[model samples]
Target: MNRISATRSELLARRAGIRLAIQGRDLLKEKRTALMREFDRLSADAVAAMQDLEEKARRARASLSEAVALEGPEAVGSAALAARNEIGVRLTAKSVAGVKIVDLEHDPVGRARTDRGYSLAATSPRIDTAAEGFETVVEVLLDFVAVELSLRRLAEEITRTTRRVNALEHVVVPRLEKERDFILNVLNERELENRVRLMRARSRTDERARQTGGLAERSPA
Candidate 1:
């Protein structure tokens, strides 16, 4: 803290500072509340997404193993290679409480049998089933990733909002109030001292007049 003057200007400035800080704190509180709500909603979504991803992955793994055992590893590998396509992901930015989060979108993962370069006629049905199972897993994984990423960003924003609220409530506002109190006390004391000095001056003037009047009466006029 720096040395402060006991002037009306300083007092007014401190009062304004306190007012603005309180408003800011209130706004931050609102933001934190909103952010928490969003986090909670997304948290539930993330949990369900994770569960779905796990289940899909488990089924995909089993399917792949069965395919390899029945149709041979070479056939499964060739099918995977033929089905390969570039996944174009589109990311858009969205804001929550001044924090930026991304919205992820992508083209569909699973292709029709005719769309893929592979032919169902050439491959065993087991191989096709295995490929479709893995494709389904990929779809679930993308959803899980999106939810998790948003959750992470929201968590960070919540932390920052909490810190700001604490600083205002605990530190900045208190300091300003203390300074305002100091200034108010000093002004009151100065006012009291001026009043006492004025009263003393009036008493001395009254005593001098009385002495003058008594001397005139003694002088015989």
Candidate 2:
């Protein structure tokens, strides 16, 4: 432990530092609270989205299986290849309670049969139904993915902010306070020592003056 100077200047500096640390701690606490709120809200949303995605996925798989059984696997695969489209996504950054996360944008899926790139005459109704189900599943999955990613980012930030708050509360402020108290004690000790020395010096001076007056009295006038 490094010893701080036992001076008024050092004391003032330490006090100021303590105040700043307190302010920092308060701000971080507020930030942590806000982050937790956001995380909780996002978590609920992500859970719902996940549930929706799962249901849609089950439906899509069932439709695809039925299509395969009716029209054969080779026929469905050919239809999928014929109906493929170039999927694109646009991602942007957004902040929630000081945490930056990604915002996703994409074109709506589950298009009409005319838009699926496969011809209605060439493909069976089962293939079209299967394609629609799968497209809906993809749409729900994208939404779920975005929510999950945001939740993860928010959780990480909350953890980081909480750690900082803990450090200030448990470590930094207490140490500075201890140092300030140490300085105060040292200054008080020095003041007491100085007072004692001054009192002793004054007593000696008075005794010597009295002795000199007594010697003068004994001499002839």
Candidate 3:
């Protein structure tokens, strides 16, 4: 009786375990799908950001070239040096959904520009041209850094999420399923044995009662 009871208990436990494992697997799959979709969206955004950076870089370079052509090299160089002293770029980190980005600020470039910006002290046209080119190069470098950092953060987050999903699907779910099956098999065997024993005991009790009646009838009463 005890064995039968234990077996029944084990069977119930196994069934519950199987149910929970299945539910967990389904939930993990859903999470994985959501993460993948996010990764795709981030990738698209990164591509667009790169394109925008490139376009801005080209514009900056062209502006510098025109400035140098009009003024001499010496003039442009002096302006660039003055701009450096007067202008400052600062980068600050901002977070969005656990990702961090460098936000750049140019303090001097737009701050002091009157109707006509600071005059270049020109020595030669070539030098002026080079000075203009330098400004464009600086702008391009700043844009590149921002885009690269953004992409790096996104990629790292995607990798971390993927690893967690794989672990749930391949490791945790399978182990739970295997344990549940083992418990079920053990319970079924115990149940069958209990049934057989109960039948045998009932047959013995019936035979004893019949013998007692025969003895009583045979005696001189």
lDDT of each: 0.88, 0.88, 0.60
* TM-score for each of the candidates: 0.92, 0.91, 0.62
Question: For model 1, how big is the CA root-mean-square deviation?
Answer: 1.8
Q: Show the colliding residue pairs in model 3.
A: 73-124, 73-127, 73-128, 74-123, 75-121, 75-122
The regions of model 2 sitting more than 4 angstroms off are 210-221
lDDT of 2 by residue, 37-153 (tens): 888888888888888888988988999999999999988998899888866888887777778777788888878889988778878889988999999888888777787888888
Candidate 3 accuracy as TM-score: 0.62
Per-residue lDDT for 143-183 in model 1, tens only? 77777888898999899999999999999999999999999
What's model 1's lDDT at 165? 100
The most accurate candidate by TM-score is 1
Model 3: lDDT equals 0.60
The segments of candidate 1 whose C-alpha lies over 4 angstroms from its true place after superposition are 119-122
Residue 7 CA displacement from its true place in model 1, Å: 0.9
Clashes of each: 0, 0, 6
